[model samples]
Target: MQNDAFMHVRKMFPDLSSHRHRDMKVSVATEIKWVVFYRATITTRDGNYQHTIGQRKTLSFKDAKIINLQYCMGVCTRQLPCQNSGYTDPRECSECRCPEGYGGTFCENMAESTIPDCGGELNATSTYQTLQMEGDFQAPSGSSCAWRITVSLEGGYRSFYRTLLGRSM
Candidate 1:
């Protein structure tokens, strides 16, 4: 959104720029026009990934947060995804930290992604929160892409998650 934010993000991932452009248009309120644009990049930190959203398109200021998007459905850019990939354009991804029970780029690791959507409570001793994001990712320990996210909390952990759309494997 701001140049300083862009600079800060570019600092984390050198590949990100402050002037990348993408021709993105969305139907917001029944109007089809360029509404967002920008560039984005990701870096591996320890056992997780850290992404920087920047270079917001002046039109929408939400589409220009990624670069070389191989998947486009909500906000990933680039269409004709390679089967089960990034979110479609126009969708904004939130930011959140994954829990121990879940791991992966999108945090959609089944068995670990959710805690049994059937009132299956966890057995931790702290607080529990949800990440600010959603995705249909293929678990690194499983086969086939699963439509899940780093949702829910366990171990009674504290609130350290935000809904952010992202792609992971």
Candidate 2:
């Protein structure tokens, strides 16, 4: 695997001088399905650093069936305006990929929830506060809930929230 990877990199960067193996991660999806992730940092003769990632999927070990051997170079930059803890979409460079609870082009609005009265804005004070939510135990599959918490920055003061405990039924 190392020799094959080196040869592949040499083909792409012909002037590759040095390379270092960074990390390898393995995830098991099922008894016969597995995913392997590889990361490496390479340097060329021109002193340019490149970060590379490779993903390999194995379907069966008995038959040695491997598929979707994908590789990517460089990091995805946040070129688009992603608001409210969102991030730029690597597949669509011009768009933002919002979080689970955020929507809109730039993730500025709250995402719609399947449960009624599930999401809303709440104000936070300097003192500790509690926000509790209860729902039917037998909710349908794919039901979702969300909330947006905000705090006013008056008098040059900042506020933060800490979760003491969280549980899902």
Candidate 3:
């Protein structure tokens, strides 16, 4: 790998100096559409029997136990994990976040904050709600993302508690 691939990479990326260490990569050397993929067939005899299946790329930039796709998978048949680190479970991500007033691993643990308040019960279900947002703002206000949560108490059992993680960006 260091003999041929390294030379090719050095020629392709001139910015890479001799002292700098580079990462290994995997890519599709050619375009191939499993001949053709039809309902229940995987034909390879193009002119004759052809299935209609799509193509996939096994592109991994790093040499880890996992595969990657930074260039984005056009039509991947198999689901791939993201290349980002420090991420726990991407799926099943429903957990109460402990903001400034609280702190912990999954944001599940809470503590008293410098911002004093008449503490009582935090009813998450009734006091707060969840909303989906998609956008990045330049300024603040109407665009400013500063927000605080409220608590609603129904009885011995708390109901409403909300969290706005990562200021709207």
Most TM-score-accurate candidate: 2
C-alpha lDDT score of every prediction, in listed order: 0.25, 0.37, 0.25
Please identify model 2 stretches exceeding 4 Å from their true place: 1-78, 92-94, 125-137, 153-169
Best by lDDT: 2
Answer with 1 or 2, whichever has the higher lDDT.
2
Estimate, for each residue in 1-169, the C-alpha lDDT of model 1 and write its tens digit.
Answer: 2111211111121111222223222112111011112333344453112222333444222233233233433453333221112222334334222222233444343223222221122222223432121332222222221122111234422211111112232
lDDT of 2 by residue, 1-169 (tens): 1111111111121111122212311111210111012233444453221212232463221112111112211235445666754556656667666534457888777666655654455555545554444432332445554544444444542212111111233
Supply candidate 3's per-residue lDDT for 88.
24
Estimate the Cα RMSD of every predicted model relative to the unseen true structure.
19.2, 19.5, 22.7
* Weakest lDDT window of 10 consecutive positions for candidate 1: 7-16
> Candidates' TM-scores?
0.16, 0.37, 0.17
Write down the lDDT that model 3 would get.
Answer: 0.25
Give the Å error, residue 104, model 1.
Answer: 17
